[model samples]
Target: MDMAETAAAVVDRQADERVRLVVTGMTCGSCSARVERALNRVDGVTATVNFATGIATVDAPRAVGPERLCGVVEDAGYEAAVQSGTAALDTGPEDRAAAALFRRLVVALVLFFPLADLSVMFATVPATRIPGWQAILLALALPIVVWSAAPLHRRALTGLRTGAMSMETLVSIGITAATAWSIVTLFARPAPVRGHGVWAAIMSADSIYLEVAGGVTVFVLAGRYFEAKAKRRAGGALRALAALGVRDVTVLTGDGREIAIPADELTVGRRFVVRPGARIATDGVVAQGFSSIDTAAMTGEATPVEAGPGAPVCGGTVSLTGRLVVTATAVGADTRLAGMIRLVEQAQEGKAGLQRLADRIAGVFVPAVLALAVLTAGGWLLAGGGTDRAFGAALAVLVIACPCALGLATPTALMVASGRGAQLGIFVKGQQALETSRTIDTVVFDKTGTVTLGEMTVSAVHTDLDRDEIVRLAGGLESASEHAVAAAVTAHARARHRELPPVTDFAALPGLGARGRVEDREVLIGSPALLDARRIAAPPGLRAALESEQRLGHTAVYLCLDDRAVAVLAVSDTVHPTAADAITRLHRLGLRTLLLTGDNTAAARAVAAEVGIDDVVAEVLPAGKVEVIRELQARGRRVAMVGDGINDGPALATADLGLAIGRGADVAIGAADIILVRDDLAAVPDAIGLAHATLRTIRGNMVWAFGYNVAALPIAVAGLLNPLLAGAAMAFSSFFVVWNSLRLREFRP
Candidate 1:
């Protein structure tokens, strides 16, 4: 190819090879600038950096990758790493470094105690001027500046060279200006004063302020470190979501060789072998073998499900005790695991207006402070104020306006609150969920397994002849069905181990009942309609049994023989012991609760009244539940919907915040924003409380962070403080704000 064509192709390749990097050890504008310069110098690399977000994106040749770029970043004393596009990285490392730096800086700060006393003694003792003691004091400051403050200087210079501003930018500017000014005044000859004899200048005291600058540098770096680490740790839920899918799977090749290959390359209808104790490679039916599979990771249930031929196996579920040959139905991003990862990624990247407001304030803060400082100094200088006074004002402006406090406030509290939530078996997802929960004014719950214990029990068994014979016959017919009522009847019969005669010509009528020939006698078990169609007249005793069951809101299955009323099987939904208490708790919290379900109206109303729900939407489909949520939202009510079925996906996705009990299938969890690992209704309250706490902390941090800057900037620019002292105070203030933010770790729901 010609050079022009080759260059065009290279540009196309560059556009396709975009990469992301997480860079650490950045403290000031100089640090960012340095990283930008170093990365740009590498072959075929284009990078964009947002100093506020501390995120960097690079487009480079595939051969010049993130691993290579990371080397360049680390060589400069910063840690550069790659993260998956699938999940948020943890903030653990950054938090630890911040903690370490903070601990060391505290010791350095304490050393300033003796230095302060010495300064006071020197100031108070008018006749004592020991040049030797003064020189010794200056020399003693070597450890504070070089050992303690070096990281800040290094990061600041790097950021400066790379054309970015960071916390180090202000510190470097304040410290360097003060140090140079003091050193020059100490050695240089003073310019001749007009109409006055030249006066010899004595030793300068301004240099003593460098200790403050150095101390501030160390402390500020510590804050950033913790902030970064906490951010990473708070995002652990996203990491678990990312780790759901299989990276590679066994592939049956056309050459008759069974080879392991990347899952992304697997095609639909391709058959593969799943070994025992290994996760299923893709979503497919078991083509061969019989065994139990543990789907707890995907379904969040401890039950090991039995799978036979044609049973759908989701990817990421282990085959605990069985080997099976499976056909690849879905792979890579199409698998259930990938679907969850995509959902989580969308939540992380979708920034709401409220979330971005913090950044907007931070964006304009630095430049405004810098401008104010310049104006303050010039105004004082033009009024015939001494150069020293003007410089002091300018130093205050730069030192006092640190934005680290604002940056760490909300995120730190959010991290702690989310962590506490995870410990309580609740996943808050992100800031959106936290904010949404705090705003939720109404809660809608699913009927089955949500407001109830999700189990069915035999309420009554009525028979014209022997009750045992009726139970045995009905249970034998119901044993073939997987429905709740069938399980209840089968379990009741099995408890007594009653001998059931074989039934021939069995038939199931969904949602109604079943029919079969028992011992050559046609027997039917179903609802009132089936008996009415058969024209069977019930005895007075059977009528009483039906009335009592209906009054209790139990499901009554009528039994008939030879078109005559024979027996009636009664089943009732089990109510959870905690459901009523949870409803009372919600009421106490001033929340309105309602039940939404597809169950019969009578049963729904009974459950709702029993649980103290104010309203019930009965015989409603999954979409109907979502519609109800929307109607409440339209009425200016914030709503939260909790569900655990694939049918609930739409409602779960459409609610203000969808909370899926982790006991559900992977599809359900993927649909909801928050996942409650424990199926307890109490977790709903726990999650809401945690969200409130996190939001409060976020607001608290923002107030401290922004409030500090507002109070400090004016003091800095008015020249009320010297550069050295201003730098130290500014560093300490920022550190204090961050340390306060770290207290979020102790938050509990």
Candidate 2:
């Protein structure tokens, strides 16, 4: 099968069962790698651990359980727990982790200033060098390097035992080397010496590095804390929606009595009542009453939609006026809101291609950094640099090259972008979707339901037979077919006939029409071309009727009885008001759009012109649609196919990026790379714009992070940079990466 066939077969795609575990105590990319290796050592388990999200997605045998996988990680010297896929996640653990980091930062900052002041006092002036002044500096920094920096120390020890290197290892070594030097200087070194310059004061054997220890701790904690806060705040919109939980709703019992009960107790086919200003209890089709529902909270639609009989309403939309009797279609986790939340969460958890490269680099970079630090210290001593100079430069190198910023570059940006995208009513399936969206230059739209509203109505009907009889016979034959034109005829007949004639020998032709025996007469309901194929000549008047509809941009449906054309029905579907605006926006992004459909050329061109589309390809079958997308790709166009979720599956899968425009209160779960929850064409541009911005942010962040290490390492190696400055730069580099990524939260299309 081709790529499109593979993608379109998403529902039938096969894979081993997967389990996700929430792991703890992983301090950096290396820690995660170690845990991953440990889990993979088990006989039937393949695992990937993501350091940014602390999630280990594992594929294992059915005999293996989640708890056992957690045990594997725990045995590798970390904490782990199973996170259920179907349940709501508890943010309590994340909150607690952030709070702990904040407390450590506060303690380190409180002590850091005093330690710096006392160290300067002991070194810069002879008069202020009182007895025990150096000891006092060490005492002030004691809590920071011990308690405030405890997590780093603990993780470093864990890494040592596992034969792995992490940022925590480099940081712990930097702090240890600095503190050990200070203790030795406090007792074994000479008394305080006043010097002429700043370098003369601290570059000698008598220098106290207590301040560097405290500063690094404060900076790393501050970066981690900021990242935690950004993640929580970025996801605020989704959390609030998820928290819109089950509430008491009035149910209309079988005997026509209303009783209040939890919405969870309501099942499919049960009728529920929604009063004015109240939220709909669940996903349902309106059985009675009329109302305008505020769907902004669920779908990000600014305008309200009028709901009456047969209108599908989402679970969380507010009923603005009139009481509604709705029969439930979905409940519990099957609701559209729940599916959206899950999609957003899944997107956040996915690791981008660049992020995986960063992880691989981090896995090896730490050990290489350790070796480089050793080489620098030894090289300095070999070149006649004194012990004081060699030790200081070595300590600086260790502190300056932590690799934390490299690890933070991509996943944090993806996390913020996913949450922000959700707020705009776009749900990306994964990082791969975002990556694909970034490259789209051509957008292909399915005309029906994509560019124009799919709902069609009878515009004009022509027949010599009794109008009622033609409507009845045509509607009966068309009802057995699920084509869009057939639906229009069926619905038009439904309003007048109330009951359709029973159809016998019913057979539906895929892209043509349907035929059956109705009330002892053979009936054929389809396009005029279908009649010609069966050796039935179209009467002159009926042929003129088809010509008139073609000129008027209407779909002409022909009804044939006993191999003679009898009547013609004209069906028209309205173009969405937002479609022109959506096309304008896509054009602004420098993208070309083409409208592809199975309708006649005139009808397709009319809708395309109304929407400002640049090209139109009409009279295409479902299989032909795939070939069109392939032809576009063969011309080197990076394509994004937009369609209604149900009928355009193959074409959607064929494009480089597939965007499914959602229906009112309905969510499509497969084929498309991105599913837009709003019933608005404008979401297409919004999604692409957001994807562009997110990728730009990620690229900028990586350049900054990699650039920082490249520039800072040389200065530290030369012993020209101060240890305190090295500590400060290393500490804030991660914070800078996260801050750059958070800018995506403010993105607007």
Candidate 3:
């Protein structure tokens, strides 16, 4: 992905580049779905609108511009603004929205209380009712409907213009119907007889429903206020990330002078000096000095890692105990921290299978409710009930039928879970990962860079020549290469001999080794296979050394001189500190585990045994790794493939759910469904556990939302439900669902 921090709207050139828009006026899931449908109408566009967060994440071809997408959303009866390219999600709009709703709600409540108190007084004591009380109630209700309820009414009208029926539409019509009926009854019907008692007044026109109008408006406004508040809190984790960048950084000039500059101005390749207790300006490698870096904030490692020259460090990490000079490698949105924030937001804005179903049902729900309401009114009239009774029944049906809860059932939970996960360095890429995680029976791990630390170090060396002579020749040729093994060999050589002889004609053989000329003689360094391919000779002792190193689960490389193997180097990778504990946790959760790698059988098995894995697939290339995953799946295993994401792309994509352990800034853009930014392997099990928690919350919300409509609609149709009670249920459900989702903010797993 391109560095997108320069502008508010970025049209990226990559395929399926994401464009985020802050959508306004979305009242329910149907409204969000409508925006998705409109945007999806553009070719090569896929979009998901999260009703709770009000963020619409759209992946579209570069040819289809963001303007067109925003225009499409505006055409679908909502407002749209492109979200800025920065990782920090602004809560300003949400706060403003909540304040506005609260102000309106206070006004509605002021009017609603007086109107309700008047209705209760009249109900309990009809003789105490004043002659002009209805007129006073009418005056109070007018503002509650026209001002307090204006937002819903306006959105309802917008959807109506587009021939759409949303939750807003249903709520708006119910409020209007109740208020309109009361207006007609108050003016058209004769006043009650002077001697009439409470029983007689019950059947008369004295029972106006102005309080229902005021109460519904107040309740719906409360719901909106709560929704706005939740949205403001939904991205707290990313917002913190956006704020973590230092305000200023001290840079080392070419002349060795130190000067301070804005953090964003420290571009790639710029050398900056970081003192103890200062946060690194951006992602970079230490060019000088040493320190203990507190990476716990970014990588979730409880202990500070040792950092010396050439050690990579993230921007948000703090330097402890020493000073260091770092050369920036990434800045702005291109940094790993920024990418992680974006990954979590995309998940927050995505729709799961169940949410999509709810959207479909919400789309059908409003119109079905309209028909049912009409049938209810007609049925009441046919049963010899008066027009007052029929209108009341119809009004109750309109108020009781709610789709807001259904629309919110999934995205609210996801938004909360994504934010909480982000704080723990877990980034969920999409909803499919959450759904798939609930069923995963096995986890396939890559040995290199996953079970083991992936960095190679020479453990021992066997050679006929003097140690210094062999080291100088091998390190000189390896210096020209960039492979991990070459780095290990060069570092080992440097420690033994401070300098190496200059080499000529250096050439690297991919996946094999390197060859060059040192001191007018051919020098080669690589695996034993490179020698066999070159028709070189290895004596029995050298061959036996190779076998012994491989048996010990160490990488063995041959150092050759003039087509003859002169020495062998045994290099090994350190096992990750948390691999064993992570595997044990997965097993405790009733999951099977396997290690899949391209390393030789002995090496793979050694790492597997150390990590407590039950099975190992060894000597498998990237494509062969996919075959192993497929074989496991063919055996009815739901597998989640875990890797560093650089070499395991194919296997990760083919698995049921891909959890990519983040290696650096450049990894994990699109390769995995779940990105583990933390270096600890424990996040693997934590990701799955978090997925299960989110799934359970979503399921509970779905049942309540759908079940309420199923059980309440019948009572409304039979005229057994009161409009005030129905309005309370409908209006509070949306707020209740959001409040339920907020429980995930405290989730540990």
Which number leads on TM-score? 2
For residue 31, model 2's alpha carbon misses the true position, in angstroms, by 2.9
Taking all chains together, each candidate's TM-score versus the true structure is: 0.73, 0.85, 0.83
lDDT string for model 3 (287-360, tens) is: 99999998767766778999999999989889998999999999988887777777877787767899989998
lDDT digits (tens) for residues 1-749 of candidate 2: 99989876763333346788888887666677678778889887788776767778888876677778888887787889887643235778889999999888898989999888777666566588778876688778999999999999998898788676788899999898888887887778745665668777765523667887787788777767887776666556667677655579899978999999987788999999999998898899999999999988877788899999999899988999899999999998898888887887778666788877777777788888888888888989999986767888888888888887787788778877877787788988888988888889999999878787878988888888898888988888878878888888899889998799888999988667889999999998777668768988888898899889878788887889988889989989978878999999999999999999998898989888878999999999988999999999999999999888455888888889989886621332388889888878899999999899999988898898889989998888888777777877876888788788888989988
Best lDDT goes to which candidate?
A: 3
What are the candidates' C-alpha RMSDs? 8.6, 5.7, 6.3
In the range 399-418, model 1's lDDT, one tens digit per residue, is: 77766655445544554454
C-alpha lDDT of residue 706 in model 2 = 81
List residue ranges in candidate 2 displaced over 4 A: 1-15, 41-44, 85-89, 191-206, 247-265, 458-548, 556-570, 664-669
Off by over 4 Å in 3: 1-18, 43-45, 59-65, 190-206, 456-571, 664-669
Error of model 3, residue 545, in angstroms? 12
**TM-score of candidate 1 versus the correct structure, residues matched by position:** 0.73
What is the model-wide C-alpha lDDT for candidate 3?
0.84
